[model samples]
Target: MTELPFATTRKLGLVIDLDTCVGCHACVVSCKGWNTENYGVPLSDQDPFGATPSGTFLNRVHSYEVQPDHGAAQLIHFPKSCLHCEDAPCVTVCPTGASYKRAEDGIVLVNEEACIGCSLCAWACPYGARELDQAAGVMKKCTLCVDRIYNENLPEEDRVPACVRTCPSGARHFGDLGDAESDVSVLVAKRGGFDLMPEQGTKPVNKYLPPRLKDVAPQIDILAPFLEPVSKGPKGFLGWLDRALSALPGEDR
Candidate 1:
């Protein structure tokens, strides 16, 4: 079995905003594209065009209809991936020592070369983040775009994970969570970010912001009554014309 490091230099992770996520699945597509093209092995698809399509994906989004105590039902888009927990159960449960958490960045990863496709890591993960690539016959999960993040050849702004870079809604943020003053940390603090499952004792580095409640009732304009016409009858010119018509033949005053 593998053992976790005592500590890590930095807790690099993501901050996702549930209020802003639109369930577009851009992150999923980008993750699949980048990993298949550049990462360890290409993700496989079985009967992709046929009825029953099955494939390996590192990231997935789930939607739910939640009804708050005092508000209407709200559709929530939740994106799930590896959390890179400080106490990663997947690492310790690996019989072949293939799954390990990085001591430098706290990023949990699988050594595909050493993986035996036992699916122990997948079973140990509480978030269901790991997947076995049928083509490579190896376990695969999100690496936080390790290749892109540390590559000196890539531009500075493009160093973030493909999911973060491709999120059109700006719902994803990545940085060192260990720091008290990093942008991602501050955002988490300001937005009251929370862990996916605190009871599991994984101490996941990633945080998620709760969706802001939608207003239950529309706002009433205070000046609406004042904007109404003072009189229901015709105005000055029309009143005169009415009086004149009333005085004509067969007209009543």
Candidate 2:
């Protein structure tokens, strides 16, 4: 039997549920911790206590307020990171072959040794996934926890990315998206998943399941037991005088 290419056999990806995410940043903290300790270089912060503090991070959670003209406001917390695209622009734009997609698992990675500190790859990426590691003088991004995911010494269940494992709300999922029978594929199919910035045509593997809406009644019962009544405190001397004056004939209060 002809062997399938390694990339096709193992296309690792993430499936994010927008509906379940509560905007908590546990995943972000987990990613920072894992990547800083285990990956090529640390994600560092500059002037931590200063007025305009800045830091380098592989993952960032963006909170977007989505409001409809007729409905209540909806908060969408989108955790942005490397999508590890099948056709990654960052790889192509790299002057050196420092940025390349892995043939074994389709994970895009950077060879820091070969990188020349040029920011071309960052520009190529429309998703703002790449960040410059000033300390190492190279571009950095999410490795999908490459070191941990493939460690033979680690337990099988703990082999997943730190972000995926640490998510409190179960909003993050990691699996082989290429496989039709994978849980991610099933979730995407069932939840009507969508890709962000499709116009860029990066063909990002990560899928985002849109938030589901709750049903609301057209009219509310103001006098319902569950509803609190508005407090009407006694009026002051001005109010008493106004009422007394209003009781007078032809008085307009």
Candidate 3:
């Protein structure tokens, strides 16, 4: 049995801003392009350019419709990938030691050679980050561009995750979550960043900046009542954490 680490020395991950994401597929495209050849095994592909396109990518963007308490309905572009939890359930659940989280930088990865494609990791992850590669017959997830980030051959400025580099809107950020003074951490503090499904106890290193609703001017009219979000009841513990961290405005937050 593989023993898990009680605590990671450093946690590195991405911070996605819902307020700025434009739903552009640039991150998705750039990830696929860079990772395809960087790793020995090219990511599997299936009719990527065809009318019905399909392919493997480390990063993905999804759109959701939400009516905030501030104003009218809105479309939120959500970018999701491996959160690289401090205590990754997927790594703990790997039967064949295929999944492991690095201690030095807290990047979770899979040893494809040891993976049996049992899919236990997939079942263990609540974020839907893991995917089975039909071509390799193994489970794979985001590696946070580990190869590029650490490659000495690449120029320092070019050593960020492909997704982060290609994000035209600068909605995606990458940094060390373990370092309290890191830019990403400062942003989280000021913008009220939060973990996804914190109740699940993954303690996801990645944080998401909530949508800034202040941009939409609050209206005082009968129609505003209908637009008020029913889901605005209570933000749960994450909300409390946000308040404790700082009192950033809803829009700037």
Candidate 4:
């Protein structure tokens, strides 16, 4: 097993807003486009024009339906990626010293030259953040765009992760989570950002802001006026049921 240093000076990561994420996979596409050329692996695609096309991606977005007892169901767009944990199992479980965390910025990185494609890191990661690049025969993951973030040639404003730059909804934020005064930290504190699967003990650097509260009055209005039906509308139990079901949460689904 591998081991990490005692601590790091900074924890660099992302803050995702569940409320603002519009289920756009721009982050995923931007990540695939940038890291394929900038980083270690090529992020190869298995079958471009075939029936089943799959590729190694560092980012993914998932949509889910949430049904609350008092309010309408909401369709949540969740974006996921490497959390760059404080105690990363993906690093410690590696038989080879290919995986390591940076002390300067706390970014988890894999050196393809040293990796043996053992797949141990993939199994060790609870978030499924690592992907095996068959062409390179190595495990790959998000580098927090170490090359781009620290690049001298690129403009300072363009130094952020590709996903952050391409996000149309401004749902993603990148900053040093270690600094309480940082913009990302302030947003987390204000929005009550939380970790993913906290019980696993990874202490993920990336945090997710929960969806904000919404008004449920219109949803509850279905039962108004003693469930009375208008002269022009359908009557009785069927009318009540129709209104109730129509006003149910996640109506767009």
Per-residue alpha-carbon lDDT of candidate 2 for residues 1-253, written as tens digits (9 for 90 to 100): 1111234457898889888888889988999898988878788888879998888888889999988888788888888889988778888888778898877788888888889989998998999999998777889899999998989999998899988999989999999888889999999999998988999988888899999876787676665877665655447887798788878899463
- The whole-model lDDT of each prediction reads 0.93, 0.85, 0.86, 0.91
Q: After superposing candidate 1, which stretches have Cα over 4 Å from the reference?
A: 219-253
lDDT of 4 by residue, 106-144 (tens): 999998999999999999999999999877889989999
| CA lDDT for candidate 4 | 0.91
TM-scores of the candidates in the order shown: 0.86, 0.84, 0.82, 0.85
What candidate 2 gets wrong by more than 4 Å, as runs, is 1-7, 217-253
**What TM-score does structure 4 among the candidates reach?**
0.85
Worst 10 residues of 1 by lDDT: 213-222
lDDT of 1 by residue, 114-174 (tens): 9999998899899999999988899999999999999999999999999999999999999
**Stretch of 10 with least lDDT, candidate 3:** 244-253
Each prediction's total of clashing residue pairs, residues at least 3 apart in sequence or on different chains, is: 0, 0, 0, 1
